[model samples]
Target: MKVTLERNHLLKSLSHVHRVVERRNTYPILANVLFKASDDHVELRATDLDIEVTESVPAMVSTPGATTVPAHTLYEIVRKLSDGAEVRLETDGGENMVLTSGRSRFNLACLNPDSFPDLKSGAFAHEFDIAAASLRELIERTQFAISNEETRYYLNGIYFHAVQNSASGSLFRAVATDGHRMARAEIAAPAGAEGMGGIIVPKKTVGEVQKLLDGVDGDVHVEVSDTKIRVTVGPVVLLSKLIEGTFPDYDRVTPKNNDKQMLVDKAGFAIAVDRVSTIASDRGGKAVKLSASNGLLELSVTNPDHGTASEEVAVDFETDGFEIGFNARYLLDIITQIRTESAVFLFNDANSPTLVKEEGSEANALYVLMPMRV
Candidate 1:
């Protein structure tokens, strides 16, 4: 195989796909990115058996063929070369790939591209397109709530599925929880996104995909099935296996009507909580208390090991007074996800969950945080 590619183009495409490459694989090819030349384009792909990513970049192809070279090695080689440097790749049989740019040259041991595992790109039965802005909002609104505990793997990813409500009719929703708190965000259900099962997209894949889509310029194509899910944005495609388990019934955990409500500026409340939490202990048993009455709300933290801190913020409220304690970190997390300038909070009492909603949107996004006994 012989191909010539511009340094920056190859680097950008490799950067997108390399995140899915398996770093520690006994099978050497698994650690490599497949470079294939076909139909006047060079294709790059990487996978960790569970997830795969593919991208195409422009290149001048002399002999159309394919080879596998260490993904990290190739990425490093291309990155270190001067910008705009032309990269030339050549393989003598399936041995090693010769890489050269200017005075820099390196040889990467190659594995037969034919041995690379065939990963599904999902001819997925169901597909839909959602605006990039909407998809970005959905990911940001709930990603902070996904659990990191592997033993409870089903909770490790943002849950995507279809749902219906009297207020919204039908919807595309994303929900995540880490036991202590939950975030639920929704967008209008798009055409062609029907009859699909829920899936848990793992944490690593989500983080990488978020970066890729963060600055993208167009709509993203979403495809899902029983075992695999794929999202295609522009020239890149990300395919990940669905977590093989059922997510916990999240609806039951959301508070129906918490009886007490308070409306305040999102920024003001979040800043007060953050300042108060500076002295709050982060240990499991520690908490920051919210005391609400009339139109005054006080956020205070008691840290016996350190000192006590408090802040009083005025909020618009008329419900019965209540005091609730919550893990300070979790509270900040839910608050930061709000997109609006104002926020609403609902509480039943010290012993029940507190509900929070961002203000001024018709969206059904809501957050639930269980009170901590302090």
Candidate 2:
């Protein structure tokens, strides 16, 4: 393969697919990216058995062929080269790949394209269009709450499902939970994505999709079967295997009616929780106490080994006094996502789940944080 691509153009496109390259590989080909040149486009692909990412960028193709080049090596070379320096890449006799820019030259070991594992692209049972921005928003708002514990493999991914909102018809939603905290975000279902089943997309796949969605515009062709799922966003396609386990009954866990409510500034709330956590014990969890009543909101943390910290912030509240304890990190995870003037919190009592919502985007996004026993 012989192609000349602009440095920035090549980097941006390669960045989308390179994440699939295994950091530690048993096979050399698995560590390389499959580079194919045809017509006026250069395609790059990498996989780690479970996930595959492919991307294409416009380039000047002189000879149409394909080869596998060390992914990280090529990326490092291009990244170190001077900006805007056009990069020329070619393979000689399928033995090695050569990269040249100005006076710099680097020869990288290459493997024939036939040695690369199979990567498939096909018709999706449900092909739909979603604004790159919209999908990114949905993923970002809920991904943090996904469970990282491997023992409970089922909670390791966000659950994508079709949900009906009493206020606004049917919506496509992404929900995640770590048993203690939960996050949910919804968007209007696109025209073609109807009657789709809930699928659990592993965390790695979510990160890959988020990386590629930057500044991208267009519809992603999304298809899901019982075993595998594929998303083609523009010139990039990400294929991943679905988690086989079933997600928990999330609906039952959602609090029904928590009459006590408090609306506080999001930034102030996060900052207060952060400061109070500093004095709390570093082990177990960073627990903080929240006291809400009248128009006052107080945050306090006491460390048996260290000292105590507390802060008071003005908030809109009208209910019986409530003191609740929660992990500071979990609070920050859900609070940082609130992009509103005031973050709304509803509670039942000390040992109940607290519902958090943003004033303008309350229904669009919601969080359930189970309080810690103090």
Candidate 3:
């Protein structure tokens, strides 16, 4: 196989697919990337058993063949090559492949391409096209809340499903929770997405999808089945297995009747929480106490080993006075995602979950944060 392509094209394609190959692999071939050159382009594919990422870049193919090479090594070599330089990959059906660029030449060991595994994307029951920006928002807004706990594997990814209502037509929603906090985002359901069953996309696959969606302005095609999901973005394609466990009904835990409403400046509240939590203990959940009454909101943190810190920020709270404690990191995570100038917080009591929403984006993105004892 002999293929020549520009360094930039090869590097970009490699960057998109190489991340799918994990650093530690049980099989040697799994650590390598499969390259197939034919006609006017070369296809690069990498997989880590659970997810597969493939991208094709334009190239000049003198000889059409396929081979596998160390993914990370080739990526690093192409990344260091001079800009606009021509890259040549040649393999003479042997155990080694040669990479040549300007004055740099390196020989890398090649693995049998036939031995590489393929995540057979059989058939999809539901398929739809969604704008890249809308898809990106659905993933980015809720990814932070995905649970890392392995025992309750259902919460490890965002739950995607379509909802139909007479009042609003069809809407697609993404929900993620780690038992302590939950993030939910929704958009108008793209055509062909109605009545689709919920699917739990693994966390790693969600992250990779988000990365590929970056800077993409065109529409992305999504195919979903009972066990797998396939996403096509331009010349790149990704296939991932869906988590088998069922996600809990998050609506039951979502607070609905929280009567007390407090609206605070998003930036100011975030800064105050950050400053006061500085002295909180780092070992456990960094608890920050919020004391809201009248028109003054005081944030404080107390640590027996360290010291104490406090800050006050004015807020709009008309209900009865109350005090609540929450994890500082969780608060900051939700606050950073708010899009409006002021964040609305609905509270029932110090023991109940707090519902947070941005002014105009309340329906599109909502966050539920569980309180912590200070």
Candidate 4:
């Protein structure tokens, strides 16, 4: 197999696909990327059993063939090569693959392409195209709440589904929770997605999809099935297995009658919480107390081993004063998702979950954070 590719083009394709190759693999072939060259194009594919990524780049093909090579090693070599250098990869039915660029040459061990695992492409039950920006927004707003606990594998990913409401006929919703906090975001459902069922998109897949959407502007093709999901962005394709467990009914956890409203600057509130959290006791708990009255909100944290810290911020509060305690880290995570300058917080009492939203936005995104005893 022989192919000549530009340094930048090869580097970009390698960077996109090689991330799926595990650094340490139980099987040697799993650590390598399968390279297939034919008809003026080179396809790079990598997988770790559950997730697979493939990227195709235009290349000058000399002898059309296929082989596998260590993904990380090849990526590193191409990354360090001179900019604009023409990269040539050649393997003559030998155990070693020769990589040549300018005066630099490296011989890398090659693995049998026949031994590489095939990524199964089954017929998808649902397929649609969504704006990359909208899809990216849904992921960023909810992914932080996905649980990392292995025991509750159901909570390890974002629950994506379609819902119907009086306000919005059809909506695409993404919900995630780690038991302490929950985030839900909704967008207008794309055509052809109304019949789709709920699926748990694993955290790794969400991360890889987010990476593919960065600085990318176009419609992304999405395909979903009972056990797998596939996303296509231009020349790259990402396929991942859906988590098997069922996600809990998240609507039951959201507060319904929280009427007390407090609106504050998102940046200012986040900064105040962060500053006061410094004095929170790591031994006892990292909780910060929020005391809100008419037009002011005070944040304070106390630690037996350390001194107490307090900060006051101006806010728009109408209801009577109330105090609530929450994990400082959770509050920061929720606040970061608010894109607008103003963040709206709804409270029932100090003991119940608080509802948070961005003010003056038609986007139906909400965050629920359970209170902690400070």
lDDT per residue (tens digit) for residues 260-294 in model 4:
88889999999999998987877756999988776
The lDDT of each candidate is: 0.85, 0.86, 0.94, 0.93
Question: lDDT tens digits, residues 1-374, model 3?
Answer: 99999999999999999999999999999999999999999999999999999999999999999999999999999999999999999999999999999899999999999999999999899999999999999998999999999999999999999998687799999999999999999998999999999999999999999999999997999999999999999999999999998889989999999999999999999999988888888775799999987798999999998888989999999864689999999999999999999999999999999999998633589999999887
Summing lDDT over every window of 10 consecutive residues in candidate 3, give the lowest-scoring window: 357-366
> For residues 231-349, could you state the per-residue lDDT of candidate 1 as single tens digits?
89899988888778899998887888687778988899989998988887767355888887778889888888898999989998886466789888888898888778888888887
Candidate 4 local Cα displacement, residue 321, angstroms:
4.1
Candidate 4 weakest ten by summed lDDT: 276-285
List the candidate 3 regions with Cα displacement exceeding 4 Å.
Answer: none
Candidate 1 clashing pairs, residues 3+ apart or interchain? none
- Candidate 4 residue pairs that clash: none
Best by lDDT: 3
Candidate 4's C-alpha runs over 4 A off are none
Among all windows of 10 consecutive residues in model 1, the one with the lowest summed lDDT is 192-201
Where does model 1 exceed 4 Å of error?
121-123, 284-286, 319-321
- In terms of lDDT, model 2 sits at 0.86
Alpha-carbon runs more than 4 Å astray in model 2? 121-123, 360-362
**For all the candidates, what are their Cα RMSDs to the real structure?**
1.7, 1.9, 1.1, 1.1
| Backbone clashes, each candidate | 0, 0, 0, 0
**Better model by TM-score, 1 or 4?**
4
